[model samples]
Target: MTRNALPTLTLLSLLAILPCSGCQSSKAEIDRRAQHIAMLADDTLDELDAAVATGDVGDAALSHIASAKSNQHQIKDEADKARTALHGVEDATPWWGRTLGNLAIAGVLIALVILLWQTGIGFVIKRLCYAIGLLIPRSTKASAALDAEAIARRRACPEQRESIAARRASDPAYDAEFVRQKKRKQRDEVSRHALPKEHMEIATS
Candidate 1:
């Protein structure tokens, strides 16, 4: 994703990013880093503008150099969003208060993982993944792989896998694209493997 879009994902990635250190860290580091990058970008932009004014840099060079200002803007925006994240969910809170809340959640998850380690995390993770719809693609692919006789009982005929069908059902635009892709795949198979197409079609159909 673009740097301008990074702030929205900051909280989700925060734990893995900065040292958790009891969640004591503030937005200072994020601000400093982004500001440093923005500062350098601004300096480069100023130099490029000077070069253009002196007729040293051409239109192509100026066009590329103009991107530096946009990059600086994105960096500044990302910093602002990160600093605002502290007060995002609730009103401005004390650092210690936020730390305690994060610690509590972390402690609970850790304790449960330790207690359940004997039971093997595989089953629990699998069940949780399915429950959260993470494994829907795998489920849909398995269904599509079934033989024609077994597939006859199914109600919905899927051209693609998983949630894409639900999307195609809702969006006429996407459905059109889906149909195009299916036709293109058939054309490719026929042209690339004409001799084997007759035998291979039934297995994938």
Candidate 2:
């Protein structure tokens, strides 16, 4: 080849390789996201399965199970589409128009994937957890532990109660005694309205 033609050919070859790399990167990203979605689906499915085994699969839980399965299917379909988009033989097209076009297409595909992940995956996972009413038990346990600690601190340092005051400001359960008294008063009022005075005491007891 002529010296001038050698650099031109090299430049064209480099341009052609760009699309292949982009496609590969896009495919890898899709696979990774798909695997994450699949794992989430599996976790939710396992929860449903456990509920079913225990015969506690209520209507709400069943609905959540269906939703989780739908999410799983959608993720798998997206992964399949991504794989199919990169299915054609590499370097089959000419280096000029086709290479540039492929590069643009790869860029667009990757952008779409990112959009789906940011707006779709996180939102779907949040909705799935909410729909299942999956309130993590650990948080409640932790709060209870905190409340007990606060109570102990209050009793141990009644004269030096700065920490207890701080906790009360920060924690909802800090005013546990007041809440309990208020609830007890409300129940007493309800019982007085609903029953005779003699029966009210028995019912409350």
Candidate 3:
């Protein structure tokens, strides 16, 4: 049998025996039995003494028999009382009580299953979407144009060019500055290396 089945069976057996077990004598019966045994012992002693004095053992035997019968009667009474108590307890627990208890347990189990299902499936779908996005490439042409414009503006400011270039090389935020400085420097170098414009107009009066 499965491990779970063993405990379940054990529980059922215990429940089945509960009614009968409760029908057995309680503390009161046990105490009554003890008292009766004590009394019987004392009576037997007295009868033994009397039998020896009167030279008649029949009286002593009769006394012993009476004590045994009294004990039996007490035991039967205790058993009956216990049975009545058990019956009352069983009556107090209605069928509806058990049904409601079982329903509550089932409801909790169902709720847990639903929560796990949502969490597991939601996590898997999120991962799948992320992986699909990784497979697709996005356009960067707009981003490139923006970088070029920012570089041109930065190159117009000569005082800020060196600082801008250093920042651009080291930090992602300074990328536009570096592009602007580089473009400006290249244009200046080209202009410096080229010939000046010639004067073709007549001298002014």
Best prediction by TM-score = 1
Candidate with the larger lDDT of 1 and 3: 1
Q: Per-residue error at 97 for model 1, in Å?
A: 15
Worst 10-residue lDDT window for candidate 3 reads 133-142
List where candidate 2 sits over 4 angstroms from the true fold.
1-26, 89-205
- The lDDT of model 3 is 0.51
Window of ten residues with lowest summed lDDT in model 1:
144-153
Q: Could you list the CA RMSD of all candidates, in the order they appear?
A: 23.8, 30.0, 24.2
Candidates 2 and 3, the one with greater TM-score: 2
In candidate 2, the residue pairs with backbone N, CA or C atoms under 3 Å apart (3 or more residues apart, or in different chains) clash, namely none
Q: Write the per-residue lDDT of candidate 2 for residues 34-98, one digit (tens) a residue.
A: 66766676676677677678976777677777777777667766756656666562434346656
* Per-residue lDDT of candidate 3, residues 114-149 (tens digit): 544555974455445434333221332233334545
Cα lDDT for residue 32, model 3?
Answer: 62
Per-residue lDDT, model 3, residue 87, is: 45
Best by lDDT: 2
| Comparison by TM-score, 1 against 2, better one | 1
User: What are the lDDT figures for the candidates, one per model?
Assistant: 0.55, 0.56, 0.51
